[model samples]
Target: MEYTKLTLGIALLVAFAWILFRNSKRSGVLHALIRIDTIVGMIAGLYLVITAVHSLFF
Candidate 1:
């Protein structure tokens, strides 16, 4: 389960990087991808932290 979560976060970052970097025509996509990764990474990191805390408590 933890491995899956790790993979998800890594995969999303990789995908976003690929898409954003590939778009050589516009810088808008750069900002968009940054926003996306920021939000998603935060959520995923929060989830992991919560899971770790929960496991410790329970």
Candidate 2:
């Protein structure tokens, strides 16, 4: 479970970076991809934080 969560987080982080770095170079499909990636990254960050805290405290 932990490994899965970490992998997901890493994937999202990479997606987020790609979206961010590519924004000025492309649009249309790339823009859509960026939006999706940003949302997924936010969710993954939240999940990772929550899980980490839960594990630390409980």
Candidate 3:
């Protein structure tokens, strides 16, 4: 479970980074969607990190 969480977190972080890089060439609604995607990815990644750490130590 912890490994799964860590893997998900890494995936989300990578996806967020990819979106950020990809957004540079996009515009309008597509750009907006990318922004939303990036935010969601970041939040999910952070949550996973926090949960993984908590589970590991507590």
lDDT of 1 by residue, 1-58 (tens): 6566556656665665565566534666556556665557556665665665565567
Cand. 1 Cα-lDDT: 0.59
TM-score of 1: 0.44
Top TM-score model: 3
Clash count, one per candidate: 0, 0, 0
Give the best candidate by lDDT.
Answer: 3
Candidate 2 local Cα displacement, residue 14, angstroms: 0.4
Q: Give a tens-digit lDDT track for model 3, residues 24-44.
A: 656654565657767888899
In order, the Cα lDDT scores of the candidates are 0.59, 0.66, 0.79
Give one digit per residue, the lDDT tens place, for model 2 in 1-58: 7656656666666766677666735665556555765767767766775675566567
In model 1, where do residues sit more than 4 Å from their true spots? 25-58
Clashing pairs in 2: none
Better of 2 and 3 by TM-score: 3
What's the candidate order when arranged by decreasing lDDT?
A: 3, 2, 1
Q: How far is candidate 3 from the true structure (C-alpha RMSD, Å)?
A: 3.3
